[model samples]
Target: MGIVINQSIKNTVITYIGFAIGAVNSLYMYPHFLGEDFYGITTYILSSANVLFPLMAFGIHNTLIKFFSEYKTEKEKKQFLGFVLLLPLLIILPIFAISILGYDSIASFLSRKNAIVYDYVWQIPIIALCMGYFEIFYAWVKVHMQSVYGNFLKEIGLRILISIFLLSVYFQIITVEQFITATMFAYLISMLLMLFYANKVKPISFRFKIPNNAKAILVYSSFIILSGSVANMLLDIDKTMLNQYIEIKNLSYYSVAIFIATVIAVPSRSMHQITYPITAKLMIENKYDELNDLYKKSSITLQIVGGLVLVGILVNINQVYHLLPKNYSGGILVVFLIGISKYFDLILGNNNAIIFNSKYYRAILFLGLLLAFFAITLNMIFIPKYGINGAAIATLISITLYSIAKLLFVVLKMKLYPFTVNNIYALLIGLLCFFGFYYWEFPFHPIINIILKSILITLLYVFLSFKANLSEDINSVIIKTLKIIRMN
Candidate 1:
């Protein structure tokens, strides 16, 4: 818990930095400089790459985390790590070959409606390979119980580099075409840096020998790849499907709304970077009691933070969008729906870590396959009808259902529940804040109105959260914030 607390706080701060930069890019720079259509095209390429990443990595990233603890001898560990490191190439190389071979068919189909996408479609696999290796190295570090640097690289460093490329585009130092090329270059650079750090953290000894039980390891990695595809598809499929169903330009509008919504999930992402390996270790040791405690604690702690973020996004959404370009405001409903689904996702804390590490992980493959089909079906049906709003609705329904299914599986099979009185309190407090702040606004500049509203919401919400003692972790954070304020 101490490690989780310390690293999660650092990761949270860093994630916030990334989110701040992303907000500026999403809200202002991308829309203002790139224009809505190119922004959509850029987002489309990224989403395709992300959706393809789990495949290219062969799910070895998660396999590394889950199996690294099981090996006893350093020799065995090296063999396992070596196997994991090399295994993804089996998947990546074939995909690269196919992508090159089939580029014309792929581009023609994808760009039938949005011709702008055809020119950039080739970059998707290149970036996916880069991003895939990045996750593999990130998991490499996490298994060694050193996640802060990896988190910085994942959450902040990539975005910072992308900001520079974006600035280059903004100043005409690079063409938009070069900007896209540079974005891929940036990912490759980051992955190489992480590769260096991961090697430093735990140098993998090259063993020409494969790990014992290599068959089982490969089998598990395959299942994880399938399951990882499900989760990634639910996330990345929206923009891709939007390009398929509507004009690519609508994706830019959807991207802004989705970015605002994603900020609500930052705490879960931050904490999971550290907690995942911890959860893996606990499960390996059969420490059910401590694991259960962590499950409940993390659920409530994240609920508290995520709930507040949800409220803040919802309460100030209108004013925030008012500050954006007029075309962008069309995603107001998109933000709300996606934001709620993401908050629901946060409250299921450690559910993913638990399932992915447990033996029941394979069972998720079937459910994920069904849900993947469900997600795509819903998007196909709805996006054409409702545009980006339809995509949000499809996402919300699928994500909510998927989260509920995962929560039920953990509760039923493992007999571990993440909910408690405190989780309920946090949810209610968030709801209370939402209603209280929704109608209340300062009659001033959009930025001023959002600031004042956020401050008031923070004051009342924090006051109540402290009074109710919704989370001891959050209370500790509050105490530190207070002392720092006094010192300043």
Candidate 2:
């Protein structure tokens, strides 16, 4: 538990730092330097890469984490890791071959909606392939319980480099075309760095031996590829589909709002790195009581922190949009809709880890595929009418449904629930702070108004959280924080 909380704290800080860097890139550098159309292209290419990478990786990243513990013997572990490492090549080569063979028609099919995309469409697979290897190495570190360095690379390194490139564009050091190409390859650099880090953490067992259970593992990896693709699709497909239906510039606007909203999910993302393998180990050992305890604690702690972020975003949304260019202001509703859906997911802590690592993981393929289809269908119906806002609505509906199904499956089938009585109190706090401060204003600059409102809201929320003792884990941290500050 100590390591879990400690590492989670470290990763949370690292993730927020990354988000802060991303905030600058999205809100200022990209808009001010790249302009809306170019920023739209930037977002489109990256989002496309993200959506495609899962299939290219063939879910070996997930397979590595799920099956790592099953092999207790050193030799089995080495062979298993060896097998996982090489499995993605089987998928990647075929996809690359197909893309090259059908390059003309494929480019034409995608470009008809927005011709700008055609020029850079080829970057998607390259970036996605890089990302696929990056995730594989990242999982390699995760099973070793060393996710901080990987998290830093993931959350901070990439964004910081992007910031530098955006500045290069601002200074006329490079053309937009060169900048885009450089940006796509930056991920390749990051992935290579992780390969070194993984090897350093534990020198790779480069043995080419196949494990005895190779067939079973390959089947699982296939299920995981579909599962992983659908998961990424749920997160990323809306932006790609938008390219098919609207002017590309709208994606830049949508990307900004989604960026602001995604900050709420950082805690879950950070905590999951360490907790995932822990959950897997517990399930393997049949430690149901301890697993349930971890589940509830994680849910409350994440929701408490995530709820605070959500409220802060909601209250300050007006000012945030004001800070952005006028053209980017239309997706305020996108922020809220996406934020709410992520919150529901945040409350279901470790639910995904539990399900993906359990025997019922195959069931996820069916459910995830259904939701992915539903999301794309809803986008098809909604984007023609609603544009970016419609995409958000489509996402909101699809993700909410997807999350609800996962939560129910975990509870009904596994009999493990993450909600606590304090869950209601935490929600009430967020809602009260949101409504109370959202309408309040100051006769000052927007920055000053944001600072003042945020301080007041945070203070009131923290005071109430402490006084009410909403979570023992959080309360303990608060106590320790105060003691450290006062030198007690």
Candidate 3:
């Protein structure tokens, strides 16, 4: 818990900084500098790459995290690491070959509706490969219980680099085309840096011999690739489907709303960085009590923290949109819909780690595939009719259903539940803050209004949450901060 708190706080700060930079790029720079069309193009390409990377990595990143603790000897660990490192190439190389052999057909199909996508079709795989390898190295560090640097590179470094590229576009130092290329290069650079750090953390011995448990490893990896693909699809498929059904600029608008909503999930993302490996270790050791403790603590802690973020965003959503261009304002509903789903996801806590590391993973994988199909079907039925709003509807439905299913599976199968009385308290507090502050806007500029309102929301929310003792971990931190301030 100490390590989790230490690293999660650092990672949370880093993730928020990244999101701040991303907000500027998505809300201001890209829309204002590159125009909506190219911004849409950039968003579509990145989304497509995100959906593809999980497949290219062949799920080895997650496989490494799940199995790394099982090996006893350093030799055995090296053998496993070496196997994990090269295994993705088996899928990546073939995909690259197919991409080369079938570029025309692939590009033509992808660009059937938006011809601009054809020119960037090649960038998707390139960027996906970079993304795939980066995750592999990130998992490498996580297994060693050193996630902060990787989190920095992932959450802060990449966004900073991309911000530079966006600035290049703004000053006319680079054309939008060049900026797209720079975006690809940015991912490549981040991947290489992670690879360097991973090696420094644990110098690679490159023992390529297959471990004795090759069959189990392969089985797990197979399920994980499907699960990871389904999860990524659920996330990025909206933007991808939007490219096919609606004008590309709508994706830019939807992306802005999505980005604003994504900030609510930062705590989950940050905590998961450390909790995942810890959960893996606990499960591998068969420490059910500690595992359940972690499960509940993680849930309430995230619910308290993420619930505040959700309320803040919802209460000030209008001011957020007001700062954006008129065309981008259409995604206000999109933000609300996606924001709720993300908050639901955050409350699930370490549910994903529990299921994925458990033997019952195959069931969840099958459920995820069904949900992925459900998501795609929903998009097909809705996107054409509702446009960006339709995509948000599809995403909201798919994600909410998927989240509920996963939660039920863990509760019923593992007989472990993440909810407790604290969750109920947190929910009530969140609801109160939302309704209390939502209609009351300060008479000032949008930025000033948002700042004042957010401050008020944070003060009231934190004060009540602290008094109620909703989370021991959070209350402990608050007490420590107060003591330090008093001393200073």
Candidate 4:
């Protein structure tokens, strides 16, 4: 628990720093320097890669984490790592060949609604391949509980590189096409760095021998592929489908709003980096009491922290859009819908870790597939009529339903729930702060307004939450932080 808090706080700080850089990239640099059309192209290409990377990785990244702890002997662990490391190539090579063989048809189809996508369509598979392996190596570190350095690389290093690339474009040192090419190189570099660091963490001695549990590993990896694909599809399918239905520039607007809303996910993302392998270990040890305790604490803590971010975003959303170009302002509704959906997911705590590492993951995978289908259908129906807002609505509905399903599955199967009285108090605090401050504004610059409003909101929300004792874990941290401040 101490490590979880220590690392989660560090990861949260790192992730928010990344998000801060991303906000500049998404809101300012990309749109202003690259132009909306090219920004949309970049967003679409990355989203498409996200949707494809799962298949290319063959789910080995997740497989590594789930099975790494189960191996007791060093030799067994080496065998498992060796097998999973090579597994993705089996899928990656075929996908590369297919991309080459089917290039024209694939390009033509993707470029049907927007021809700008045609020339750059090939970058998708390359980036996806890079992203796939990056995750594989990232998991290699996570099983060793060395998540902070990986988190820093993922959360800060990549974005800083992108920021530099965007600045290069702004300075006319690189053309838009060059900027796109550099983006691909960025992912490749990230993967290589992670691989190098992973080896440093635990020197890899590839056994080149199949583990005794090869069949189980293969089966789990196969299920994980669908689960991973479904997860990615739900996230990026709307953006991909939007490319098929709307002008490319509209995606730029949607991307801005989505980025703003995604800031709310920082806490969940940070916490999951450490909690995931821990959850796997606890499940393997059959420590239900500790697992359930973790379940509740993770839920309340994330809800409280994530709730503040959500309130801050919603209250300041208009000001946020104010700083953006006028063309990007159409996604106000998108932010609200997506933010709410993200909040629902945040409150679920480590539900994903619990389920993904459990025996009942197969059932959740089926449900995920159904939800993916529903998301796509909803996007197809809604995007043509409602545009970007439609995509947000589809995402909100799909995600909320998916979160509810996961919560139910965890409770019914594992007899564990993640809510307490603190949950309701946290919700009220978020709502009260949002409604109370959203309509209030400062007669100053949008940036200044944002800063002032955020400070007031944070002080009020934190003070109230602390007074209410919404989470013992959080209150203890507050106490310690205060003590440190007083001592200083």
- Candidate lDDT (C-alpha), each: 0.90, 0.91, 0.93, 0.93
> For model 1, what is the error of residue 169's alpha carbon versus the real structure, in angstroms, after optimal superposition?
1.4
Question: Stretches of candidate 1 above 4 Å error?
Answer: 483-488
Q: Assess every candidate by TM-score.
A: 0.98, 0.98, 0.99, 0.99
lDDT (C-alpha) at residue 380 in model 2: 98
So what's the TM-score on candidate 2? 0.98
lDDT of 3: 0.93
The whole-model C-alpha lDDT of candidate 2 against the native structure comes to 0.91
lDDT per residue as tens, model 4, 127-217: 9999998998899989998899988988899999999999999888999989999999999999999999999998776667888889998
Tens digit per residue, CA lDDT, model 2, 234-273: 9999999999999999999999999999999999999999
Q: lDDT at 33 for candidate 4?
A: 95
Worst 10 residues of 1 by lDDT: 204-213
The C-alpha RMSD of each candidate to the native structure, in angstroms, is 1.2, 1.1, 0.8, 0.8
lDDT value, residue 149 of candidate 1: 93
- Candidate that beats the other on TM-score, 1 or 3, i.e. the better one: 3
Where in model 2 is the C-alpha error above 4 Å?
A: none
Q: List model 1 lDDT by residue over 258-329, tens digit each.
A: 999999999999999999999999999999999999999899999988888889989999999898989888
Residue 182 accuracy (lDDT) in model 2: 87
